[model samples]
Target: MAILTNARMPVETVNFHLWQPCNMKCRFCFATFRDVRGTVLPEGHLPRRDAERVVTLLADAGFTKITFAGGEPLLCPWIIDLIRLAKGLGLTTALVTNGSLIDSGTIRDLRGILDWVTVSVDSVRSGTLALIGRMTAARAADERHYLDLCDRLKDAGLRLKINTVVTAANHLEDLTGFIVAARPERWKIFEVLPVQGQNSGKVEPLLVTPGQFARFVARSRSVEAYGIRVVPEDNDAMIGSYAMVDPAGRFFDAIGNGYTYSEPILRVGVRQAVSQVTVSRRKFLARGGLY
Candidate 1:
C-alpha cells in the first residue's frame, strides 16, 4: 500500500500504546481493559511486531520524538527493547506509566534509552486513591515507593514529568500540595476524561466539565511557583507533539486518538504506515479541534 503522509503541518511527536489493559483501573481512563476476566495480558496478544512497525513508520514520517504509553507501558515485558529500538533510530523516547512498575532494573535499563518518564500520582492519601479506583486495603505504601523511585530517577539524571489527572475526587483544598509533593521537573495537568463502558456510571459524577476544568487551571498556579514547568494539555505549545503512534502501528491524532484508517497499520510496512499517518493528520488538522 502507498500511504501518503504529505501534510503541511510540521509533524513533531508520536505516541504509542504498548498494551490496552492497565493494572490500576483508574476511573477516568478511556483505554480498553480486561478487568472482568482479571487478565491484564490477553492470550495471543503481544505487541512486538506492531511496535517494530511503529518505529519504522514514525521514523519515515519525520518524527524525532516518540512516547510509549499504555494502561501501563512498563507491563509490555519487552518495553526496554522497544525503547532501545526507538533510541537507536535517533528518536527521543518517553514512557508514560503508572509508577507501580518502577524498580531498580527498570531504571537501570532506561538509563540511556529514555529521554523522559512520566508517572501518574493522583493524591496523597488513601481517600483520593479510592476515588481513582486504586485503593489500599491498609495504609498505602505504594505512594512512598513511587516517590522514592522518582527521587532515584532524578538522581540518575533522568528527566521526569509528573502526570496529574485532576478530578473532583482530588483534594482540591491541597491541590498545590499534591503537585509540589511530586517535585517533578515537569508537571503535566489534565482534565479528567470520563471513562465510558463498564466503568462509566461509577465515575460520571466525579468529572469536571470544560468550564470547571478552566477554573481549576486558574486556581492551580503553584506548579510554576515550585519551579516546575506546568504543561497544561490545552496549551498550543503543549498541543500536538512531534509524533504519536500506537502499538498497532496506528498514528495518533493531536489529542491522542488513533488515526482514522481502515486497517491496523501494523499489518503493513513502515512506508505505507507513514503515508497513512500523513493522510490522517492532514484530514484531522483541517477538521479543527481543541488538539
Candidate 2:
C-alpha cells in the first residue's frame, strides 16, 4: 500500500509492448489474452508520431530506462527508429525478443542504439524447444541461429540477457551449456504463469509445481561458475513489479487473474494513466529494474 513518496520520484524503468503480432506460437504466451478465438487481432501499436510523443513524454516525466517488448518487438517496422528516438532522449533502451527473427542484419542495425538485448530461450535441447512449440521444424538450426545471434550481439558491444520460462515441459533440461556459450550479463528464469483468459486452460499441463521450480533453480546454479547471474521470478514476484505500457499506450498490471489496463496515455496523459496501475517500488528494486 505504499505509494511513491513524490510525484517526481524518478521511474527507473518502463516496458512497452509495441505490437501484438508474433511469428512463433509458443504454448505459454501470456499475450495470448489480446487475441480473439484463434484470429489475429488488429495491430495495436500506436502510430509512429504518437509513439514518439509517448516516449518523449515518459522520458521527460523521469523515466530513465525504456524496454521495448511485444508479441515480437522485431515485427514492428519502426522498432529501430523507436530505439533511436529513445536514445536521442537520453533514455537507456532495451529490447526483449524471441530471437527467431534475429539475424546478422538485425543485430547490425541494433548496434549502438540498443543498450540491452534479452532473448527468450526456454531450453537448450532442440527436442524440448519443438515439444514446447517454440519452433515447428529445424529446431536444431533455430537453436544454432539463436546462439550465433547472441554472439553477434555481444560482438556489436550490446549487453545481453536471457529469459527462460521454466515450465513442466523443459524444467528438467540442463541449460548450463547454453548459459556458458551465450555468456549473457543476466539470465532471468520465470515460473510458468497462468493468466485466467490467456493461456490458463490450454497450458495447464505445462505448469510446474513449486517443488519442481525449486529443483530447476538449484540445477541452474551450475552456470554461476561461468559468471552468469541468474535471477528467478515466480508469479508473486513478477506481478506488480513491472511498469508496463501495452501496445495501445495504456498502462497495465497483472496483479490479479487477468490484466487491468488504464485509459490510453494519449487520451488521459501519462500521469493519470500511470496512476491507474499499481507499481511496487520494493519489488521493482529487488528485480534490479533500476539502473
Candidate 3:
C-alpha cells in the first residue's frame, strides 16, 4: 500500500542532509544519523563531485526547493559548490544549520546563492539550553548572540526562518517576544519527537505531551501580529511527511516505529528510490510543510 492514502503528489521539496557531524549536542535531535556514522559514511560526507551529482539528481527529480541540512552543513567545506549547482539548476536553495559557524562574512558569501536559512533555536534560556544539551564545546550561546545572528541574516537581505523544538525543558517558556524580535519570514515549531536509529533512547528526558505542545503554540501565536508565520508540527504530522536524503543520499521516512530507507539514489534514481520510503502529501500539507 502507498504510505499516503491519497496516492498522488510529487515530492517537491527535499532536505538534502550532509553526512558530516554536528558541533552541538542536542539530545532531542532525531536526525543524528548515529547508526551510519563512522561506518557507512567513514569520510564524513560524499566527495565534492559526488555531492554535486546528488544535487543534479534532486533537481532532475522535479524538486523545486532543496534545504541543505546536516549534522551541520556549514561544516562541509565544499557546500558552496553544491549550493551553486543547485541554484544554477533552478532549484530554490536554502540551508538548515546550527548558526554556530555563520557570521557576517559567511552570510555575505551566501547572500546571492542561497535563498534563506533556518536556525534551530530550541530555547532562549541558557539553563534550558544546557539541560537540553544544545551546546558547542560545552558552552551555550546566549539569547543576545542568537538575536545578533538573526540581525546579520536580515541585514544581508537573505530570508530568515527559525526552528524551535519544544520539549519538556522549554514548553513553558514564552517565546513570542523572541520570535517577534527575530523578524523571520517564518518560524517552525516542532514538538520533541523520538525516532529509532537517532534519538530513540536519548529523548526520554525531553519528551512532552501533545497538550504541552499545543500550549506552547498558543503562547507563541502573538508573533503572527508581527507578520511572522508560525507553523506548528506535532508528532503525527511529522512522520512520513518530509522527503529527506541522508548522508548516503538515500530517501528515508518514518511510517512506523522506525525509519525505512531506500537504496542509494546514485544507484537506482529518484523515482525508484523514493518508492521504498513513505511520504504523505496530506500530512505534509497538514504540517505546513509547504511554504
Q: What clash pairs does model 3 have?
A: none
In angstroms, give how far residue 173 of model 3 lies from its true place: 0.4
Model 3 scores a TM of 0.95
lDDT of 3 by residue, 1-291 (tens): 124223322557899887558888789988888766656777667778778888898888778999999889999987887898899999998999888999767887898899988999998888888888888888888889899999988888889999999999999999888888889999999989899778987898889998999999998988999899999989877887889998888888877667677888899987778778888777777777777
State residue 221's C-alpha deviation in candidate 1, in Å: 0.9
Question: How would you encode candidate 2's per-residue C-alpha lDDT over 86-157 as one tens digit per residue?
Answer: 999999999999887787788888988999999998976777877777874445335577788788899999
Question: What are the models' TM-scores?
Answer: 0.77, 0.93, 0.95
In angstroms, the error of model 3 at 114 is: 0.6
Candidate 1, residues 190-234, lDDT tens digits: the string is 776543343466567677766666766667776788797766553
Error of 2 at 196 (Å): 1.6
- RMSD to truth, every model: 5.3, 2.4, 2.1
Q: lDDT value for candidate 2? A: 0.81
Candidate 1: residue 70 Cα off by (Å): 0.5
